[model samples]
Target: MNRLRTILFATFFYILSVPIVMSVPVSALFGRRAVIRHAHVWARMHRLLYRYIMGVRVRVEGQVPAGTYFFAAKHQAMFETLELQLLLGDPAMVIKRELSRIPFWGWAAMRYGGIIADREASAGALRSMMRAAKALKAEGRSILIYPEGTRVAPGEQPPLQSGFAGLYRALALPVVPVALDTGLVWPKHGPKRPGVVTIRIGETIPPGLPREAIEARVHDAINVLDRERRDYRMVQAPPAA
Candidate 1:
């Protein structure tokens, strides 16, 4: 039954995604927000899909803001997005440029006010992210960023890149650290496990502090949350400056 349900889930996602892909060019001609509104409605459908079809349940800790904030989450599984959208509403992600180039998901991301970043571009990437984030914030939107950048397996930690600190330094907005036991269930590469996934929204840490301090604190914050609730535990602290 689970396998059949998974197949249906894949089918539903692809079928709905086609229109979003085709509509990108038209949305591009209009404005990012115009398409973003459409995408928001589209993503809501995904929540229903996960809840009713997939039977996925989510539990969130801490608080989500009505205003704007920079949200950073540990990347492990697609389950992260469900909680993010549930908490912050329409999320404009700081994604790789590759996503913006694809049909539908990529194009709609661009047309939908998502921040498509170029890691190799160096200077320009920071500026572009800030601009996109600012625009989204002005429109009463929350931004989701993955500091670890990519999903990895259980017990493995991805190196947090420097761009996260740069963006925080530039924006100086409130930062929320989110942690989840997503990899345990919806792992990067594995058969889906049946169960509820746990997530927590940490207190908003303000920017304008030292980069090392901010990054280390966020790291520990997530680790503490994940450890308390899951099989994971922190092994080492950030090296001294």
Candidate 2:
């Protein structure tokens, strides 16, 4: 029955995604705001489908802060990617340039002003991402990035990618560290487990901190949601320096 439910969940998401994908071109013609609004609606619909079809619910810990800032979140599975939109309305996502080159989805991401990075481009990629993030900040849109750069096993801990640190220094915005154990129920590639995915939003780490301080703080913040800790408490942000 679980397997069947998983199949149904995947099918339902893809089916609805087609229309959203198709509307991208038209939304692009309108502007990034239009595309972002459409995407927000899609994310809400996705949350509904997962809840009704798969019995998976989302429980957020802390209130998402207002105004433009950086959100450095743990990437467990594809779950958080979809869930973040619902959580933060429509923050500018930091994604790879290759993802921005895809057909409808890519076009929408590019048009919607996602901060695009090209790892292969080395320093240039970081520069491009910083410039884009700064633009989004000016536009009063928050930015979200997976500090690990890719998904890891639920219980495992990995050092954040160097790009995250660079973005922190260049963008100079307070960084909100988010932690989630979605992978416990939604593995990177496997059958879906039924449970509530808890997203714990940590306090905002102020900018201009040394690299070691920021990275260590973010690393601990994101790992708070790991199963062993089992403490789902809201972590208050320290007073900004």
Candidate 3:
């Protein structure tokens, strides 16, 4: 029964996604903002689908910070990726450069001002990312980066990618570490369980710290949502729309 629901929901999700994702390029004929509008609409539809089809709900505990800041979030599943869009309005997401090469979505993401990072440690790629991120900061936009670079299982503690500290130093903004256990309800690539995924935003860590200091603080902050922790309150997920 669960498998059947998962299959049905997954199919519905992608079917709806084709048009939503394509809207990016179609709207590109208008302007950058138009592309972003499509992106935002896509995010809202994704949340609605998750609620109605998978029985999963999302909510935040601490207040989402305001103004231009670097957001470091724990990556446990794909759910948090969409959840970030809802949490921060039209954020400049730091994603892999490879994703920036996808067909229509890639072209739109670039036009919409996503910061593309190269995981291969190429100096030129790093330089380009820093330049893009700085420009986004100047526009007073918040930046979201998955410090671990990829999704990990619920209980795992992996070191953040090498580029995180560099981006931190380059941006020189207060870092707001966000924690969430979305994987408990939404696995990497499987049927999602029915539950509320709570995202806890820790207090901001100001800039100017040494690399070691910043990484240590971020690592501890995001782990607050790791499976072993019992520090937060859970609420009933809201009903499907």
Candidate 4:
């Protein structure tokens, strides 16, 4: 039965996605904002499918900040990639260069303010990403990044990628750490289970802190929901002085 539901969900999800993906060029014709609006609609459609078809629901704790703040989030599944766009009001997303090369979808993503990072290029990638991110920031858009760089299994907290710190220091925007338990249901490869996924928004950490301090704070804050870790528990950072 669960398998059947998963199949139905995937089937309809991609079928419905065709038109939206195909419409990207038309949306681009209007303008960048129009493309972003189209992307938001796409994200919302996925949310609806998650709720009604997959029997999955989201429960967010704490306020989702408005305006041009930087967001660092836990990445345990592909779920948040789309969901955060809706929750953060279509913030410019930091995504892989590979994703940005996906033909039509890729072109639309760049037009919609995606900062594409070529991971293997190291220093050069960071330079390119910073340029794109700064441009988006100047446009009054918030930035959302999965600091761990890729999805990990539930309870596995990996050190954040160096790019995270570089972007934080350069962007100099307050960072909001978001933790979620989506992997429990939305495993990388399997039938998704029906459950309430909780997204915990941690206190905002001020910008301009040393690399070590900011990385440690974000690491702890984004792992607040990692119950499987023997030492796991929420460690809130003291209010920025």
Best by TM-score: 4
Question: In candidate 4, what are the lDDT values of residues 140-213, reduced to their tens digit?
Answer: 99999999989999879889988899999889999999999999889999888899999999999999999999
- Which pairs clash in the backbone of model 4? none
What TM value does model 1 have? 0.83
* Minimal lDDT window, size 10, model 4: 228-237
| Model 3 lowest lDDT segment of ten | 227-236
TM-score of each: 0.83, 0.91, 0.91, 0.93
TM-score of 3: 0.91
What value does the lDDT take at residue 230 in candidate 1?
45
Which of 1 and 4 is the better model by lDDT? 4
| Candidate 3 lDDT, 88-131, residue by residue in tens | 76778988888889987787778888888887968898888989
What order do you get sorting by lDDT, best first? 4, 2, 3, 1
Clashes in candidate 2: how many?
1
Across 138-173, the per-residue lDDT of candidate 1 in tens digits comes to 877778888877775655555677778877876678
lDDT of 3 at 159: 89
Tens-place lDDT digits, model 2, residues 90-176? 888988777888877887777777788776648877887888888887888888999888888887889988889998998889999
Instruction: Give per-candidate clash totals.
Output: 1, 1, 0, 0
Residue 238 CA displacement from its true place in model 3, Å: 34
lDDT of 4 at 226: 87
Highest lDDT among the candidates is held by which one?
A: 4
Question: CA lDDT of 52 in candidate 2?
Answer: 87
